[model samples]
Target: MRSIKFNIIVLLTILSLTTFAQTKVVSNSYSFGIILKIEKFAGRDFRYSLELKSTDTDSLKNIVIKVQQVINDDEWLDVNLAKDVTKDTVWHSLKISSKINPRAKEIWLYANFEGNGNFFVDNLKFEIKTESGDWEKFPIKNADFENNENNPLKDFRTNANIPDGSTIGLRNRTDSIGGKALLIKTTKASVIFKTNYGANKRIGKYCNINGIKIYYETYGTGEPLLLLHGNGQSIVDFNKQIPELARYYRVIAVDTRAQGKSIDNDSSKLSYDIFASDMKALLDSLNLKKVNVLGWSDGGNTGLIMAIKYPDYVGKLVVMGANLNPTENAVEKSMLNQLKKDLKKLQQKQDTESKQMTRLLLMLSTEPNINVEDLHTISAKTLVLAGEKDVIKAEHTRLIASNISGSQLIIFKKQTHMVPNENPLLFNETVLNFLKQEDVKN
Candidate 1:
């Protein structure tokens, strides 16, 4: 229950600045150190790294990084580094051992210099994380996950350690999505793990919500942000977004009931309210009272229902390509026609994957009948966003925006329903700006 500024630092004679995902010593001239204070648990893995081009790279003996644990408001005790590695004349890293003080409320990583020379550091990043909280916010520097062509498997892999004979190809979509993840911003916040996969496994869990097993993965650290997938799509639908949002928020991306890895208990029907109810239950299971909600397509419809029905549970709402009614006017006829064709092709196949795909398609073709007037009932500050060339009509998006009292509306030009994938930088920037606003009246 700490404030956003709980990470307040007291750097001594060091010029430092941090953007969305980067922290650096802007221009330090004296024999100074960059100090970062974070509210995190003890005995957790702490890793930080930065490049250095000092007045002399010939010697790093002047560099002495000291890890400290807070005792009181003003007192700190030296904590031993699990792996002290300041020996490199090149880019050095500080990998603090998992050994931490239990009474410590805040830990500080100080880059100390004692000699007469100067030390310069940039690309500074810190990670005090566990496995379940593992997330990767992909930065623009080297993000290339979206190059899939004839085969989707080329872009995605099944979770680690699938059975020897497990299915491959698009079946990777259903198998499970797990691997070493990263989160990169202007300056990459990297966790270089020499540890094995046991320590690197992304935290994936299943919780019983609304009498069904809801599967989800959480990553990064900050205000809780919920990501809901589209109809017939899995949490992997947000493969591009998770890395983008994890840069600032603790992202909880879920596979809604009856879709993706979630189970429906043999129920053939799924509704927005039911999905919304499951989301509420998920919050309860996670012990989180309120979270920011970002939903796309059918998930967006569910977000509207959640905001309207369970106002207290939603802090902010961002819905993209959502429709009040599942009709031709509300949604594009071309999209419906394509879904019909895709469903028909799936229905003709007898494979299990085809059956599952067809089931989800059927759900999308129908359901979601909202009253545009009911949009006024949403108490959470809402952001109704849609692509200029969205499957959901532009006027319909405007209607949703106009109805929500103080909602912000943005229609991205030259984009379709898949703006999150097609134009991620724009989509992420808009969402981050809206989420970061501190004075929005609900």
Candidate 2:
């Protein structure tokens, strides 16, 4: 009887401990979506992301962040928030992502640190992704919960009755380095997002280019004007000039393979030469013997390759922000570093969209190393364009012009790499004037 009593007690104790451990707070997360406040933010979708530094108060800390989407009033669908997670007790930066519903009027967020002890999370920030795929830190606007502007929730909402002995709200705390840290302390949390719809107006068609479905848009009638967008861009990059250009010419704006609406099928690693070849093949598929090509950024670099290697197919060319060497003036070092970090973050995702992004980011950070002498061989009438504030250095842009025989160089005053978007009126006029200029027939 004594032995049996001791065994039963041991079994009960084990069960109690197991249950306690499983119930401990570990996985952390937040919600962001469908907050209808201002008119500007209404009827849009967004890619919401979070980045924050965390310190564990206990060695048994296991951290994970997840996303949940609202299905109805009482039930929510489980969404994967962590692209990749590594359990650690040390200081680490957490990255989590989720998307917002354009149609839903409301949404919620939840998070927890599921382990044996508490961990202080700080430097917490929620970001909404831009059309360029860059994340912008969200600032508080319309602190009102409803029509009432004085509601206590500055930028979020949470329930006070949740059991787990965990607290979820903003708190003041000191960091390990003796600095003031304001943390959005949460065993669970929620936030908001407003989408920008500038890039969604145009729908495009995809045609096979070297066995890959390349997305493109065409309009108007005259000579074929093949407009190529920059790195990480779509047909929308030329939104400012498309309509005007279409009025004068048959504008063929193409989204390079694996970018925008285009899908990729090539098994080999992508390169500028590959894109150039694809553009040449696209022209062939459309039954055009020659066409005028206008390229921006990476597109410009690809144009240089096309004019050099497939000289006969390109009648006239305009290359903007093209660089012969990436190390020299391709982009700022800080921008390159950010690309590397973004590539690392996307690597953890199992989705094809994420993998395609990794490929494009990889292409931007490395690869393109053009020889200036190659420019001398291009047979087409060429225009080399750049912005004064372009990411590519001034001298490098001039170098490209010097090498290309009789090429015209024009630098837009006070403009940057995104001249097409920032100074659309000027960009359209300049490109149109150059395209309409009569040079001796090629």
RMSD of each candidate relative to the true structure:
20.1, 20.2
Q: Each prediction's Cα lDDT score?
A: 0.63, 0.62
By summed lDDT, the worst window of 10 consecutive residues in model 2 runs over 189-198
In model 2, the Cα lDDT at residue 31 comes to 23
lDDT of 2 by residue, 220-293 (tens): 89999988888777776676678788889988888887887787855457789989888888888788856888
Per-residue lDDT tens digits of candidate 1, residues 1-442? 0110111222222223433333444221112222344444555666554334233322222344445666443335655432223544443444444445656766555443322233444334555566587732212221122223233223221122222222222111111332211211112112221211111134667888646788888877999999998876777667668877888999998988777777665536667888899999989888886699999988999999999898988999999999988788888897788778777777898866666666677777887888877888987888999988788999999999999988999999888887776667888899999999896444
Q: For each candidate, what TM-score against the reference?
A: 0.54, 0.56
Residue 221 CA error for candidate 2 (Å)?
Answer: 0.6
Which candidate achieves the best TM-score against the true structure? Answer: 2
Clashes of each: 6, 11
